[model samples]
Target: MQKLAGVLQNFFNQAHAKGRLRRECFGNLIYYRLIDDSQPFRRGTVIFEEGTLIPGYPQIGRMIRLDKGLKEQFTKPFWAEEKVDGYNVRIFLLGERLLGVTRGGFLCPFTVDRLPDLIDERIFSDHPDFILCGEIAGPENPYLIGSPPFIKEDIQLFIFDCQRKGEFDYLSQAEKHQLMEHYSLPSVRNFGLFKAEDILAIKQLMMTLDTEGCEGLVFKEDVPRGKRSKYVTSDASLSDIQAMARYLPDFPPEYFIGRILRSVIFLDEEGISSTHELKAQLGSAFIDGLLKAIKQCQREHRVYHRFRCRLHDRANARQLLAHLARGDGHIQIVKHRLVREGEFYIFEFDKVFQRTTGLLGELLSGEMVYD
Candidate 1:
């Protein structure tokens, strides 16, 4: 079944070897280069083979890190609310039509930044097998805002994952909330089966979701209380740069990502010879928001939020890679084998996977790791 033109001609006859690229062409769709240029992909993103075209989990509710002694061991009638820090979306309905992705995998190109708001895109690029993972949040969106501002953000879809029609696996957590309230899609305020004396009340409800900016709490064990582990992400950012990357010292590895980019001073401030041109126009607009926030945090594989700058030579690196390749947005080539000599400088856009190659087997799974 690999006929998409023989899977786009064996994905560009192997992306580029010797120089190690093999694929990167755009205009049709392609992407693969898993982590060469010296590995560095700390999380997830790049999910194809099921209908790619992601971006959906902006969120609205169900992030309530529950646990007051597992709330009386959750006697099966559960539902809690309000626990936001922002961003974590997903929405994909099958028998009706809807699609989105953002729990790392992106695809939203602003349409009021959609969410559980499906209108039909074939649930996401024509399906074959079933699918419908969800998350997008805000405990409840009144409207919108960003950075660190909010009057009330918005977005919430939270379905979790259904992939097939086994209705909801080995059930029980009150039968997966009566099959997510008979497919209304939004269940999990309470689904406990706790023991070990509820891990110190779910670690004090993850320190009350890190003192309310929420971002921490996940300890799955739900398979009639057994088979559902490894699913946790909530330290949304207690930020102090994780205690300064824990006592920084030679802290520039993981393919270098500390992009403050412009600052003769002011990572926290330190430079004012009569406000030297107001610190060079606030270090060139924080080095243009550190190259547009490192192309939006390496397009989702956050890589523990790193992004540095301050390079140019090579004729300002072909005019900053031809001004980030004449923007329209599309930059996810996080550090591909970077290296530099003195006065240090590195940019490595890993040729953005030759240029795009059908998104490289959904970035790394197709061709299933060289089959």
Candidate 2:
């Protein structure tokens, strides 16, 4: 299954770029929820048969709501590492050629050229089929956050997750360290394991990285599934907002409004009592730009058609789509269709104003690394 998945991944990747595949119409990151043979439930229509590979959307957390007892949830153990404020690049060793894929699985030229030299050739030899996932960062990253330009040597490929060549299965922490040591590749700063009850301490630790212009911290489990989540800094959030405005001028009003609410939520989570302080920190220009973008989006909403998407789980899909439509009052589900394929329930949602920018955003966010 893993081998086939790898082959299919590479094939679809190249095929989609050449306009030979229609799967790109669905989204940038095609997720396949692989069903087991032993399971009683019939499998849904998916590109892959092994496991799910949903889009590259980050799992956002509620800062204030989770603060109450969320800190105690990690009493067992969790691995934390500094989140780099750079583009996500997944380097694959395919045959003799190295491909740098963006979060959306598109070939990236910038990462391919800039990062290959930094990796030791012998590491590829050891793991013939391996996926080295990391952030291509530094002052000269040339993406996302802009900083002072630096030499090529200054650019860093901070490997965070080492996975099986095509599949998303991650290597153990010890294995990752061994691989990094063998190749002499630098990694994101690791905070090791923490069992402290004080969530405030974790926040403080993240703040120190923020002082250094770092984005945030990613938490990983020690055991199976290796669930990963991130806590981003306000500075990082602001950068993302600005990037959205500068790049995606036609995005819906809901997107900007969502970010605005997030801003307020994050500020309140930080215990800021004064509205004046929050307003001053957010800046009038930033707020004004978002408001302007919202108005523009509102104007566009008046002339939109229903967007559609297919999903395997009906209830969950409705909830997720409804959640996405919250910020922008314009986007709403007009219809829902259910197709029963054996025992599986296939869901289809007709939404107002479907945009392909979701995939485009993921693609353009990083430079293509290819031949």
Q: Which pairs of residues collide in candidate 2? A: 31-53, 32-52, 108-368, 108-369, 109-368, 109-369, 254-328, 307-351
Model 2 earns a TM-score of 0.58
Which lDDT value does model 2 have at 160? 88
> TM-scores of the models, in the given order?
0.25, 0.58
Residue by residue across 131-172, what tens digits does model 2's lDDT show? 777887654342333431222224667788876633435788
User: Which ten residues in a row are the worst by lDDT in model 1?
Assistant: 34-43
Give the per-residue lDDT of model 1 (tens digit) for 283-360: 444355344434533464232222223242434333434433443244333444334646534434432322232333
Model 1 off-target regions past 4 Å? 1-55, 62-128, 132-160, 163-191, 194-200, 203-215, 218-236, 240-371
> How large is the C-alpha RMSD of every model relative to the true structure?
20.8, 15.6
